[model samples]
Target: MSGERSGDRTERASDLMQLNAMALEETELSLHEDADGRGDPAAAERLHRLADSMTDTARDIADRARNLADPVPERERR
Candidate 1:
């Protein structure tokens, strides 16, 4: 981490965020397919809950990664 720039970390985290968004979109499509096309409300509801949990986890991951990537004070680096 010594020589790494904050910009690089920010970009990686941003990419992760984008990927998370794509995952959510895919989940939505699947939910629609199950709920609307197949009329399986139970399965659709499960998928919906999974997507919600994933969203929270993804945000936490992105935030943590960004925070870790930032340069720490000299004393804190140890």
Candidate 2:
């Protein structure tokens, strides 16, 4: 997988590896905050949306990383 430092594919994979964990951690924390019920109703709703967005973004990033790490053959790409 190529990163900003494309010379080191291992480094890129290692860096990509962190995204899901960080994203999930943030998602859980956001949901926890919502459950704690400290914020106003509007804020809670927004927080839920934020959590969903985080999850979706994480999945997208992870999918991209996977493709980079294991590139598809040109024939298979079609």
Candidate 3:
């Protein structure tokens, strides 16, 4: 990763984030502790929060990658 290009790094990070999100969604943590075999609401909520944060960070990284690829002129940048 030390020598990785910006686009490659961005794609890798995005893919990893997606993989983790899928893993979290498939995890047994959401299974209920009772004999009913129902879903656990707290676990589901925590999963969603984690997934959302990962997604948001991936988006931010992508935005940074895009900016690095085609940066605004010094005078034009906000």
Candidate 4:
């Protein structure tokens, strides 16, 4: 049986990706502040790493949603 309705699934996935992207942006700003103004190199480095990981995860989530939303080709119809 199908689990989530397609529209709901797509909306939820998009929301999650957007949230992650926002988090990444916030982390980047924090990283810049910590490095350039706060004199906390260690914190900046950690935040930088977190931002990078978040970016990768967000892209993966978007890719997954895109793959799910793609229609099956007529030649491949069951």
lDDT of 4: 0.67
* Candidate 2: tens digits of C-alpha lDDT, residues 19-78: 774768687677857756845777777777777777777767766676667777899978
TM-score of 2: 0.62
Q: After superposition, how far is residue 52 of candidate 2 from its true place, in Å?
A: 0.9
lDDT of 1 by residue, 15-68 (tens): 777677567667756655555554567876777676667667666766665565
Candidate 4 ranges beyond 4 A from true positions:
1-36, 72-78
Model 4 lDDT, residue 3, Cα: 84
Q: Given candidate 3, what's the lDDT at residue 17?
A: 56
TM per model?
A: 0.48, 0.62, 0.50, 0.53
Q: Rate the local accuracy (lDDT) of all candidates.
A: 0.66, 0.69, 0.57, 0.67
Q: Which ten residues in a row have the lowest lDDT in candidate 1?
A: 30-39
In the order shown, the candidates' Cα RMSDs to the true structure are 5.0, 4.4, 6.5, 4.4
| Residue 72, candidate 3: C-alpha displacement in angstroms | 0.9
Regarding TM-score, does 1 or 4 come out ahead? 4
Q: Per-residue CA lDDT of candidate 4, range 32-62, in tens?
A: 5655654577876776677577667766766
Q: CA lDDT of 16 in candidate 3? A: 66
**Model 1 segments more than 4 A misplaced:** 1-38, 71-78
TM-score of predicted structure 1 = 0.48
